[model samples]
Target: MARVEELLGDELLEAIRGRAAGYDEANSFCHEDLAELQAAGYLKMFVPAEWGGSGYRLQDASRAQLRLATAAPATALAVNMHLVWTGVARVLQARGDQSLEFVLREAGQGEIFGFGVSEAGNDQMLLDSRTVAAPQEGGGYSFTGTKVFTSLSPAWTRLGVFGRDDTGAGPQLVWAFINRQAPGYTIKDDWDTLGMRASQSCTTVLEGVAADPDRVFRKLPVGPNPDALIFGIFATFEVLLASVYAGIGQRAVELAVDAAQRRMSLKTGRSYAQDPDIRRHVAGAALAMDGLYPQLESIARDVDDLADHGSFWFAKLAGVKIRATETARQVVELALRTAGGSAYFRGSELERLYRDVLAGLYHPSDDESAHATIATAWLGPPED
Candidate 1:
């Protein structure tokens, strides 16, 4: 497997990093960054070599995302959406299910996949849906609902969307992909936010958007089930998302150390690095991060190796994402303090990271959902 540095490269990273703040300040999408990443074949990291890709695994891709986010969180995050789909296909295909092999093949051919699963006010993500999937002729389903936070909105060639189908015996969740040229949908330009602005994750309104028969993928029951496709999506999304924020935490630690080493104590005639209080603060953050890194790695490795956590899988995936994101937020706070007042400025990298890390709170499997999942696994479902 090719290492992330080799694919992303130092020069490419510096250029992308240089453009990050401009994208944020202008509240624009990272078009240049996306073009560069595509040119570098970053999208094909998980596709097999036979399909013109690097043939890497989840662990490798997670590390790549970490490194990418350290340089540019918003850019990395926007790109993360695409990687999630590819990674999901990789996960499912590796386990002997080729239902999504076309995803890999197309991604290998340079097509970008946008994630369109998220729906506003629908917390039972993946397990249920609010988007309506009305059955169409020839086994197709026309999805009609709004998809929020549609990352890679400006560049996706195929969008992976899901909805609920009532025509079935019971409510069945339908997962499908629609082409960007599909007529009935509209991509709204409404992504201005506190941070991660470069992502340009706009809202996509599906007015009976058409998902052709062949493009429609999984159609499982309305609630949780032991489907491999669901597992692939859940595992890939949690692990990769964790990697991005974990990168933020790791970078924050570095910045904290750098700020401490340079900050002078007016009364003591020494750097803050020599101050016990500052040292302890930084060390505490570092300890949290040290634990986080391995947790992320172990989970990614497990997904790659297909380690059977069985019922514990959801708990572990949820736990790692919760830990990586929450830890990153705390670490960024320490970095800001160490960087001293200057970091409060809008253009400061630490300031950017501080805002970027906040998005982690909104990702799927939120605290309530994640805790509920973990509790149910350990304590069994609560009595009716």
Candidate 2:
């Protein structure tokens, strides 16, 4: 069989490059387009075969996401979150101790799974969530709390929420696949943000909702069984997120090069593309992008190795997240500056790319945690 990258390369690239502008205009992807993604079988790449999915590998999944992000950051950001969540959900479902098959099928079928993990004044951890999951009569629980910055909430069929059990131990994750047509959950529709505006990230409220125990992926104090297996899973997710931003950066450079080729400097009566300054800027941007490719390739290779050998996965995961995070930021910024003030305008592709690339910094790594993880790993055992 062809490698996953070989399978998804051209198609993923075409999808992103073709639809990026429309996604920007819509400020989020429409349901019909999302359904098309499902129909294309792209939505179920991470889903297991038993769930009527291709059971594709994670590396293939990462390459596909990277391709999508390159076309439209918001679409990539919103959909990538669902893809990673689906991957994680499949792992939990495999336990059979926590059967989330019904919802998994929905997610596999391209149902939006808006992440409701970020909370006010709380770091992005399950324990920090204010959403409460209380025991209900019979066997379910009632959930009440607000989540902020959820991507694609306006179009989501379900939301994957993490909160604490009022009486139980540790953190509890609940998959609340509420009806978007219902009033049980309200989308604030107030996600006016500085970056990734097309993501349609909005606040969410879940009230008086009944959740079955079986729907709960795993209780807090989760055993090492799934957690250990999931470490590599999350590592791959980080790679996917960063890769999308890198694609955005790549698009930024492309836009700048295209513009430079057409622009002329009045003073010298020469195409801007021929000017030494423009050449230097574009060269630098390409170099940065080139640097990203090898690193991304290495990350894909390393992740595959970890899955095969299961060693040093956590540390390597942190390193790739950090590298992709910083490089994407630099590459996009270079593209913006190279394009000059015109790139700041609404019509400028670089403007959208600028906003989209910034989203990577706020992803799981966030510099601080990524650095800490690397530092802690480096300082292991205090050197004896």
Say which candidate scores most in lDDT: 1
TM-score, cand. 2: 0.83
Across residues 154-260, which tens digit of lDDT does each residue of candidate 2 receive?
66666666555647555454434444554566778787776676667788877766555655554454223335324534665777777777777677778779878
Instruction: Please give the lDDT score for candidate 2.
Output: 0.66
Candidate 1 Cα misplacement greater than 4 A, ranges: none
What TM-score, over all chains together, does every model reach?
0.98, 0.83
RMSD of 2: 4.0
**Quick one: best TM-score, which candidate?**
1
The local distance difference test score of each candidate is: 0.93, 0.66
Give the range of the ten consecutive residues with the poorest summed lDDT in model 2.
221-230
